[model samples]
Each structure stands twice: as structure tokens, then as C-alpha cells.
Target chain A: MSGEPLLEVKNISTSFFSHLGEIQAVRGVSFYLNRGDVLGIVGESGSGKSVTALSIMGLIEKPGKIKQGEIIFNGEDLMKKSQREMCELRGNEISMIFQDPMTSLNPVYRIENQMVEVIRYHNRNLSRKKAVAQAVEMLRLVKIPEPEKQIKSYPHEFSGGMRQRVMIATALSSNPGLLIADEPTTALDVTIQAQILDLMNDLRARINASIILITHDLGVIAEVCSRIIVMYGGTIMEAGNERDIFYNPQNPYTVGLHQSIPSNLAISEKRLVPIRGTPPNLMYPPKGCPFSPRCSYTMRICLEEAAPTIRLSDTHISVCWLLHENAPKINGYSKGKIVDRYKTPSGS
Target chain B: MKAVDDVSFHIDRGETFGLVGESGCGKSTMGRTIIRLYNVTGGEIFLDGTNLTAMSEKNLLPFRKRMQMIFQDPYASLNPRMTVTDIVGEGILVHNIFKDRERQERIFELLDYVGLKREHANRYPHEFSGGQRQRIGIARALAVEPELIICDEPISALDVSIQAQIVNMLEDFQDEMKLTYLFIAHDLSMVKHISDRIGVMYLGMFAEVAESYELYAHPQHPYTRALLSAIPIPDPDLTRKNKRTILRGDVPSPIDPPDGCRFATRCPLVSDLCTKATPELIDKGAGHFVACHNV
Candidate 1:
């Protein structure tokens, strides 16, 4: 909508060189992140949502290589940058918060040590004492009860919700421009999931940081994302604003995802139309659309050919043969309160 | 569907009754309590018109054979070293229902009854997938030929696609054996599909109990209302507009619940009366039972 975008990930293709030949993890994936923007990478369990994020951060491990594409951040392409250069930018310019904080956080180290180190790494000029104080303040911002006391407590001592708060606090310590959250609340209770989402939204406002969230649930994308990218089987099936993706889905995969949700099962269509088949084996993906086997609207072309990207405005786009030239008519049967919700907005 | 709570419902011989709720609620505890699994924790426990709570273990033995439990976790429930044949036929061996070749034959029948191949009877629990292991567990429970089976979150750990299969199998068995079930699980929508009646548990107590359709369609309890509202639907527009009744804090610890109404802490419509007195689960109309200060 404006001059230069903050981050433009151009045609990024990542692959893992396994014994089964080069297994492509991210197939020519391309998207951009803007300042104060919350971009949601939505997909099912094995949709390469996490891998796409890792590629941007240059955190992909050995054997997995970014063969093509440039992650252009502030004019400097992170893809072309040296590993040393990327390391300097990490935690300082771009911070990441992963799911399952217990595994990421060291069992031996105190919470204070990790947080203070992050602050010192980014803003070296600040004193250790001042940084530790800021860490406590950041902990309080995430709404953790007794932050002063909890800071001294180990990751094991805190509950699932509290540990996530600590993780978020640590992510913010560096004052990064972009915050990458990967299924941060999937393990927590629904109530706690809501609170964590609220915290992330509030923190975005406080720090003026852009967010890139990866989650399995589309509803989560609606609640937090300004822009949504629906991925399936290592490729972007659809991209749009929160309104367009949910209200007027173009991709058959996207429509299938909507119908797969359980809320509508009890209301109108008692039948739960789960994606008919399991996700294609990533080791050797199908020749055409990875979702073609499971897609309800599978045409002949959908099996042998890839659909060209259909742009529905500046904000919405989908990749599907159904939208191809004379992309024959299709109707979807999706119902219940949540589906019908976007007709009009409540006076907020 | 009939208002199961309203009908003064009692299962016939070999009937399966399903009781469902979310995490941290007391549905699992209710299963154990009814079966005297926790030694009769405050309830009038009756099985086959016999008072089970008052009966001693020696006397309860005969009645115990009338009931059995299938746990949720397949990985943890079955002893790793035990073969499927041993696991299934153990009940028959214990009760002296069959001996040697007869027990083996009974185990094979159970395996066939639960949709497992008779050939899988000798395999270890570690060798099976989540769904197959659950099938084996069901076969073991059926081997005893119990009238009532307490399925405690049976399919919760399995995949969604696998969930419907297990539920259908259970339904078929219930039809065939006239099995009585206390199906406990956290899947509310699935519960509505499978259960004749639904009981919404909150903070170790039943918030609402009514027929499946009636309870989900028009929930009486505040906690139920809030819980239903908070679930995000796949529909984007409705999800955005639907006023989510986000419960302020998480469910309190069951060990030390609130003074009066257990759900009063998180209930959006909590009043002064809730703090002073616990609400009785009264029959409002059409068999709906709700426990709230004001509904």
C-alpha cells in the first residue's frame, strides 16, 4: 500500500537433500511482511508452515538448503548474506518464539540468565543490571503473576501458560522488528490459548513490531492476522485478507479446509467432511496439485497440471484450477453461525 | 431426540451410556466414582438395581464383573510385555469364566467382535498404531462380557479420521451386545453426534445435563454459554463477529475450587448470590438440569 515493504521474501524454494533424493520442503514460496503487519501462515499439520518461517530466519539445519529465492529485508537480502551476518541480525533485528518452550529453553539455566543475555546481545551499550530490570518489566507486560519472583523460577517451575509468557518476554527483549511465533499456544488449554493470543496482539501494539504467526487453525488467523496465507502440502494454495479468505474462498483446498472444521458439524451438515485422504507423502509428492487426491473439486487438469495464481484484488489471491479460464462453476455447502458471521460487522 | 435427563433415564440390560465433558472437568472422575474406582466418592451408586457403594469388595466382585473400564492412553494403559492374547483373556482367566483353549477361543471371538484380526492376538501393544491399540483394548474389555463399559476418553488421543471409526464401532457393539457405556470425552461436537444425552462438566461438577440437541442448541448454564461462544468456527465472517465470551481466567484447581458455585470465578454472569450459596441442579423444564445461581 506504500513505498518499500519491510520484508519481501521472493520465490523462496527450500529443499532437504535426503537419501530419497532432494525432498523439496518449500516449493517456490513467496510472500512479504510489512511493519505493524500480522501475517498468518495457515495450514494443516504438515503444510511446511514452520519450515517457511525457519527459512526466513536462516535457521534451517544442514542438508536442508534454500536453493532459490531472496529474503530481502531492508534492502539487504538475508538469503545471500553470510552466516555470520545472519547471526548478528538474529535476536537483535529479527526474533523468534517457538512452540513448546520447554524444549527450546535449557533445563539447567535460570530464566533471568537467558533473557538478560538476549538484551545484552542486541543492545550491548545497556548495563547488565538495567537489562535484567527490563527483563522483569517485560515479564510483567506479558501479564505473568509475580514476575519478580517468577523470573528467578526455572522453566519447570512455571505452568504451560506461564512458560509461554516467559518465552514471549524473551522474544521481545531484543526489540526485534519482526516477531515470528510458531504455534505458541497449541499445547495450552483453550482459555490459555486465548490469553496468549491477546498478549501477542497487545505486545504488537506496545513494541510496534510486525508479526508472522504459523498455526494449524484458521480461526486463529482470523483473530490475529491482518493478512492470511493458506498453505497445503508445501505450497501456498491461497492468500488474502482475513475477510476474503473466510468469506469468499477461491481455492478448493481452502474450501475443503473450511468444511473440515467441526463447529458446522452439529448445526447444518451433520456429516463431518474431513479431508478424504491423508496428506501426500512429502518424501515423494504428487506430480500436480499436492491436494488433488483429497480435493472434492478435482478436475482432470488438477491431476496433471498446476493452476496459475488468480488474483482477486490487491489483497486476495488463490491457486486453483477451479478459478482457471472458464474455471467451471462450483458450489460449496458450508454452514453454521461462524460461517455466516461475516455478513456484517458488530459496531466495535 | 428425547431429553435424556428429562426422561428419568435408566439403561436396560447391557446398555451403554455416554458421559462427556472438557479437560479439567470431572467426567473422568465421574466414571471412576460410579464404578467405585475411587472407592465411592460421594454419590448413590447403583448397578443392576444393587447398591454398589454399600457392598464390600468380596460382594462387589460379582458386580465388578458386570462392569469394566477402557483407558484413554494406549501407550501407557497396557503392560508393554503383555501380549494382546494375554491382555484380552486375562479377565476370563481371573473370573474363571473359561480355561485354556476356551479362553483363547473367547479372546479370538472378542478380537473379531471389535474388528481386529484374530491373528493380531499375539502382538505386543508397542507394535500397533493408536487406532489398532484402542481396538485391542476394546477387545480385552469385551472378553470379560461386561454389561457396562466405562470408555474414559477412548478416542481422544487418536486422529480425527480414526475417531469416527472408533465411535461407529462402539455404536455397533452397543447395538449387538446391548452394551451400557459411560463414554467420557472432551469432544463436545462429537459427543452431540454419538451421545443420547450430554452432561457439561465444570470445575469438578456438572454445570448442565440435558438431551444432546437441547443442551447444545440452548445451553442454560453460564459456563456452557461461555465455553460454546469461545470456540472459533471455521467460517471467517462469523468467527470475527460472533461475540466470544472469553472466560477471564483459567479453570481453578479442582483440589481447592471456589466456595459456592465452582464455576463462579470464570462465569461472566457471576453474582453475589453465587458466592454465598451453591446452586442445586434443579429440573427447570423438559428434563434440563442446570446448576447456576441465575439462569
Candidate 2:
């Protein structure tokens, strides 16, 4: 909305080549992140949210490749960078925290060794003693008590929440310009997840760093993100500010997701309206809108070709046939609630 | 070590009682123990006032037909090699609930009842999606015509939209058949929505037990209060405005847990008395129960 954004991912498509077929994980996803902005990418399994994050980090492994599009970070195209250059950028300028902390961390090594190594690698001029001290300071920033003493303990000694904190500390040790957290609080308890979310909010303001938080939980997204991208079947179904996405969601998939969760705190005797049918099989993905098969207001045109992106506002966009200018008007599908909720057919 | 200890609760004939806690909090163990899947080290479980713990394997056969459990992971719970027909009808055949032609018809009826087509009966578990697999699991569980169903995080693995479908289906079945349910899950919001009553477990003990509305509106236990506040409401404004009692540290390891109270280590209002003498679950009023020294 302001000056040049911190990171801009343009028309990126990532796919995995298997014997069965090419599984298009992320297809033509485009979004930008401004400095100090917390962007949330929300999607369920097979939505390709995680793959989009990996594509940005240049971490797509064998059989999986970024087919096209440029990843521009701080005015430079990251796709042009060599492997050596990408390695230097990772964990230094751009860091990522995964769903599980145990897998990313070294079990045998002490917390100090892992953190200091990351610190020193990004800043070679810093002495080991200074790096160790910096490591403890980072640990303290994440609110891990007794950082100096805890640094000597192995990853196994810490609890799930504590281990996640250590992971965050290590990731932020270099003061990375952008942080990408994929399902950071998914494995944690509700109380522990709240603590982490609060800490992340505090640290965001303290450091003024941009974050791309990828998660499936809409509640988690509401708690932390300023802007939200709702993904489905490897494509973005809707993109808007938190208010637009939550208060006035336009896309059928987005509406379906909202209706599915029991959000009202009143505890009324209301039943949930689940989106009928499973996600499209990516091996033979739809010829038209990815969510067309499961969408309630699917028009004949929706099954023939892709839905046109309708700009609801300067900051809100939804990809759905119902939002199109010439599309048939449907009643009672407004403000994220469907009128025929109970009687919504369970797919033909 | 006692996976579940000092936990006493009862479920009405046709009510859903939610058991909620973090991982390794013995919620699943409690569910399994009630269904007689796990051997009880201590305590007794009664189903319709009949002591299930006292029954031997030979005598337990009849009781086993009356209760069933739906697991958390749909991917892991179903047999990969088994056909849907066989999987759903296995229990029917085991208990001799139906004959040759009737069994086939019953299997198709079950598939249809769970929103699955009769054609899907020939497919393997690998052919179905997570939600469909869960339906198949539900069908298999229902095949025995059990009076009680233990849904152990049934919708946790499913997507948000699909979760509502499964929940609504369960509710519909509950109303139609009047089946009792032990809904065990970590997600508090859904639990509050589904359960008539809820039990909040910390380590091996319930911190609070009350009606769903009572538990959410006025949680008495210190642990329950913090937990209720911790849930990130879907509304952005409400979530931001809500003042959360963020629990400082991790849940203390259940192994060799503190003598007096398992939650004392992380409890915000923990007093010396809490660590010295264990608090008993005492009824406050209106069928509400809380175990806390401070409250």
C-alpha cells in the first residue's frame, strides 16, 4: 500500500513430477509483503500453502521445481541467484520456522552450539564468545527463562513449547529481514499457542520485521495477521485484509470454510455447514475453477474455465464465478453465511 | 506410571460428555480405558450401572458389542488392504448380527447412511479422502449397533469445512438413535459446541467438570480459566480485545508429577497450600465442579 514492498512473489507456479502425473502444488500464486507486515496464508491439506513458502525459500527439492515466475526480495530477483548466493540468503536475510521444531533442530547438540553456529555463520566477523552471548540474548527475547543455563541443555530437555521458542530464537538470531513461519503453533497446546502468538506479536513490533505466517487455522490467522490469503487446491481463492476476509468473505470456498467452523461463542443449538465433497484430486485437477466441484453456486461456466478475479475493493479480491458481472444472482450467500446451510446438498 | 488417575465421571445414556486436554494429558487413555481397550490399573468403569472393570474377557464380549471408539487419525485407523464392505461388516459378522443376504444389504445401508454410495463399498480405504475414510470408520463403529461411541478427536484431522459435516452427522445420529458419546479432543471450541458437559484434564486428573455453557461462561479452576482465555476466537476484534492469561511455562512432565497438584508448577495463582496439599474436586453450585485451592 505504501512504498516498494519488502517481498513480491509474482505468478509463481510450483509442481512435483511423479510417475502418475505432474502434481501442481502451487499454481500461479501472486502476493506481496510490505515491511513490518504480517501476511497469513491459510489453507487446508493439499492447498499448497507450504509449497508456496518453500518456493520462496528456494527449498523445492528433487522431483519438485518452480516452473516459472520471479521472487523479488528487496528489489532483487531471488530466482536469478545461484545456489551459493541462495544459501547465504537463507537463515540470514530470510528465515523459516517449520511445523515441527524437533525435525529442524539437532538433537545431539546443545542449544548454544546450534544457535551460536547460526549466528556466527551469518556474521563471520563475530567471535565465538560474542556469538554465544548473542545467542543467549535471542533466547531471552523469546522469553525462555534462564537462557544462559538453558543454552547448555540439549533440545530433548525442553518441552514442545520451549523447543519451539528455541527454534524461533535460532531463526531470528540473525535479525532476518523476512520470517516465514509454516504452522508454527499447530503442534502446541492452546495455552502454549497463545503464549507463542503473543510473543510473536510483541517481537514483530520490537524488530519491525515482515512475516509470512502459513497456517490452516483461521483463528490463528485472525490473532496475528493483518492481511490474509485463503488458498484452495493449489490456488488462492481469496485475498483481503483481515476485516474483509472475516467480515465479508466473497469466495465460495472462503464462505464454506467460515461456515464449517463453530465460531459463535454463544453455544447455540446450531449445526455446522460443511463444504460438501473432498478437495479435487490434484493428479487430474479440474479444467476450470479448482473449487468448482465442491462449490454450491457453481455455474456451468465455472466448470468450463477459470473464474475471473473480481476486485471487490482496492484491498480485496475474490476468484469466484458468483462475483462476476454477468453471473446469475444467488440469494442468501452473503457475509460468509449460507441461507440453505442445513439443506445444502452433499454434492451431486 | 498412571496414565489416568483419580478420574471419575459418568455419561448419561444419550448425552455427549467431552474430555479435553493437551497431548499426553491422558484423555485418550481415559477413553480407551472406558471402552476396555486398555487394562485399568486402578478405578472402576460402569456402563449402564454394570461394572465393566470387573468383567473378564469371556464375559466382556457382550459389553464390547455395546461400545465402540472412533480414533483421531483416519489414515492410520483403517486397514489399507480391507475393502469398505468387509471393514464395515466385520463387526456385524463377528457379533453375528446379520445373515448372508441381510449382511450384504446392511453393509450397503450403512454406506448409504454415512453419505457414502453403495458403489464405494467395493473400493479400498486408500481410494477415499480423509472425510470419507472417517465416514467408513463411523460406519464400521455403527455396524455393531453400540449404545456408546467414543469419538477420540474424530474431526481433528479433517479440514475445517469437513469437520462441521462430521459433527452435524454425529449430532443427527445421536438424536435419531439416542447414542451416548465420549467426545475426546484437544480443540476446546468444537468440544464446547458438541458436548453437553465437559471435563478439563491437566495431567492425569480433571481440573474442572461442568455443563458446556457453565464451563465457558464461568470456569472456576485456575487451569480452566487460563485455558478458556487461551483459545483464539475467530473474530479478530474479539481476539485482540480479549485479555488472555498466558500460561508462562510448559505443562510439567506427568511422570513423577508434583505431590499436591500437577498444575502447581505453571498455575498463575498457585499458593504454597496447593503444593503442600492436593485440592479435592468440590461442587461449587449448579452441577459445577472445580479442583483448585485458590478458587
Candidate closest to the true structure, highest DockQ: 2
Candidate 1 is graded, for docking, as: acceptable
Positional deviation of residue B102's Cα in model 2 after best superposition, in angstroms: 1.9
lDDT of 1 by residue, B151-268 (tens): 9989777655456567778878888888888778765556666677777777666778887778778888987777666555666677667676767756766667778887788777
Q: RMSD for each model, in Å, please? A: 6.9, 4.7
Q: What is every candidate's C-alpha DockQ against the true complex, given to 2 decimals?
A: 0.26, 0.79
lDDT of 1 by residue, A210-250 (tens): 99999887767877888888888788887878777888777
Candidate 2 has an lDDT of 0.89
Q: What is the C-alpha lDDT profile of model 2 across A1-348, one tens digit per residue? A: 478888888878999999889999988888888889999999999999999999999999989999998898999999999999999999999999999988888999999999999999999999999999999999999999999999999999998889999999999999999999999999899999999999999999899879999999999999999999999999888888988899988888988888888874777578788898889887788989999999888889989997666666667777777876577766633322221211221011
Candidate 2 ranges with C-alpha deviation above 4 Å: A331-348
How much is the lDDT of residue B25 in candidate 2?
A: 92
Off by over 4 Å in 1: A13-24, A63-68, A106-110, A145-152, A205-207, A264-269, A299-301, A305-308, A326-329, A332-348, B1-22, B32-45, B48-151, B154-181, B264-277
DockQ of predicted candidate 2 = 0.79
lDDT of 2 by residue, B77-191 (tens): 9999999999999999989999899999999999988999999989999999999999999999999899999999999999887898899999999998889999999999999
* CA-based DockQ, model 1: 0.26
Least lDDT summed over 10 consecutive residues: which range in candidate 1 chain B?
A: B1-10
